[model samples]
Target: MKIEIGKDFPKFFKPLYQEEFELFSHFETTAGIPTVLFAITTWKENGKPNVCFHSWSCFHGDKTAFFAVMGNLYQHTHTYTNIQREKCFCINFLPISYYDKLIDTIHQNDLETDEFEVGNFTLSQANVIHAPIIQEAFINMECTLKEVQDLSGAGITAMIIGKVEHISVDEKYAQGYERYGKDGFMMLIPAPQNILTGEPNQSAIASVNIEKYD
Candidate 1:
């Protein structure tokens, strides 16, 4: 069965482009689903600097966040420090197919260690920031922290709202790219879902909503 939704902006359902689409299923949606590793580097409250590697992220569209933290805990995060000082960050999303390299980046690399050097990845300077970009990944979002909300005043994990400064991606991930289309990119849906329905609808629904506000 097929549901006729908007195939363009201001429509109810959005058709997925081959490269830049995710699904909206009850079990697993694309909004906040994907495991990635990023290098957390900080300048410092003092005059020193440091960096570490983390394997988690729950970001939002430059205004809200998808993070969930328990209690007050903000001491040893290099990412948080960088954002606090520079007011910017770059999140690089990786495909789970590169699990091994992702794992390599999750360890306690030194302050000046480069994850791309250890992992099977490439680094490129971002379009709008001084931070490096993951050239091998499917998506890279350079964002500025608009706000950081501490839920319950517990600093364990603050919901960071970032304004997307810029976005760079592979041409293959383009929405109209035929290669990542239904039969093109052999990727895991990441859940039990309708391959055609979920992803396409996500783009469609989002497009419709954007039009409503615009």
Candidate 2:
């Protein structure tokens, strides 16, 4: 038989942290979806380089244009405000090895903090945008803000879309299939809750493991 999860919050679903439930819906843990992790670089109003280690986003486009649809960006984050004021940002895709460095940026991030320094990253200007990029990233996509929407209308998080203007790929990883293994991309595995017992599990950082070609 199949179990049914209805619109009402599941009584059997418990969050690992109360604050997490407040910031993110319980469904997040319930679904435990995984997404690509990347660093969003911008200039804080104070002129310090800001790096937001983030996920919950997708990228796609057609012949006309491409877009970066970033979701669950907190309205209060400097990254959000910076994008609004600067009208641009850069997305840097680093490997799983830099996960710890990225986490350091999260802990040390303040209005005046130079996040690049916190992560011991080499900063460089984007070729097309007025934002900063991480030189270590295998791929860097420069984007201009296209739109922002309060998808839930709850005044908490937002879905910010950016038009991809240009992409810079590291010459070493330019070869096809090179950007798919352990040194390629990082992923975020959401904390999963035990559906039957309501016990919460820890979130994890992961790398892609290719098993097949299709």
Candidate 3:
């Protein structure tokens, strides 16, 4: 026998936090998707540096260009507004060691706040864009805003596509295989619900481990 979930929010679904289901669909916990974790850096209109700890995104390219397809970005966020006004942003990838620092930026973020200072990070200007970059990051991808869409048409979140203009990698991680294991990339493991009992679980941070190369 197999358990089946439909499009509607599951009645048996439980929320791990207040407004958890209100902010995210029950399907998020149902499927418990995992995605890479990174920081989206931008300049707030107030001239303050902003950092948005983010996930639910993918990167790809064709022969002509590359793109960063960022999903589930809250429309109310400063990062969203900054990107809209500035037309650019920077994606910074750090190891798990910086997870707590990144989280601090989330709590300390205010329109007047310098998020880089909140996280005890050094701010560096991006090469091709006006956005700020985290100096401690292993990789920094400077991007120009390409498009923004309200995929659900709910006006709550948006899918933002950014054309990757430039990329800078730490010398140590420039090697091919070095971009794995503890020092490589951080991942966000969405909270999983017990399908049988509909019990909510806690989300977790993870590191990539190279099991095999094929």
TM-scores of all predicted structures: 0.52, 0.97, 0.98
RMSD of each: 12.6, 1.0, 0.8
The alpha-carbon deviation from the true structure for residue 99 of candidate 1, after best TM-score superposition, in angstroms, is 2.0
Model 2 bad stretches (over 4 Å): none
Q: Candidate 3 overall Cα lDDT vs. reference?
A: 0.94
Candidates, ranked, lDDT: 3, 2, 1
Error of 2 at 165 (Å): 0.4
Give one digit per residue, the lDDT tens place, for model 3 in 149-195. Answer: 99999999999999999999999998777777788889999998999
Please provide, for model 1 over 1-214, each residue's C-alpha lDDT reduced to its tens digit, 9 standing for 90 to 100.
9534343432232334433333222333223343334433333344233333443344443254332221222434656666777776666655444545665755734556655666756667678875666786567777766777676454455555666777776777677343232323222223332434454433110000122322
Candidate 2 has an lDDT of 0.92
Point to the candidate with the largest lDDT: 3
Candidate 2 TM-score to native: 0.97
Clashing pairs in 3: none
Worst 10 residues of 2 by lDDT: 1-10
Candidate 1 vs candidate 2, lDDT winner: 2
lDDT-superior candidate, 1 or 3: 3
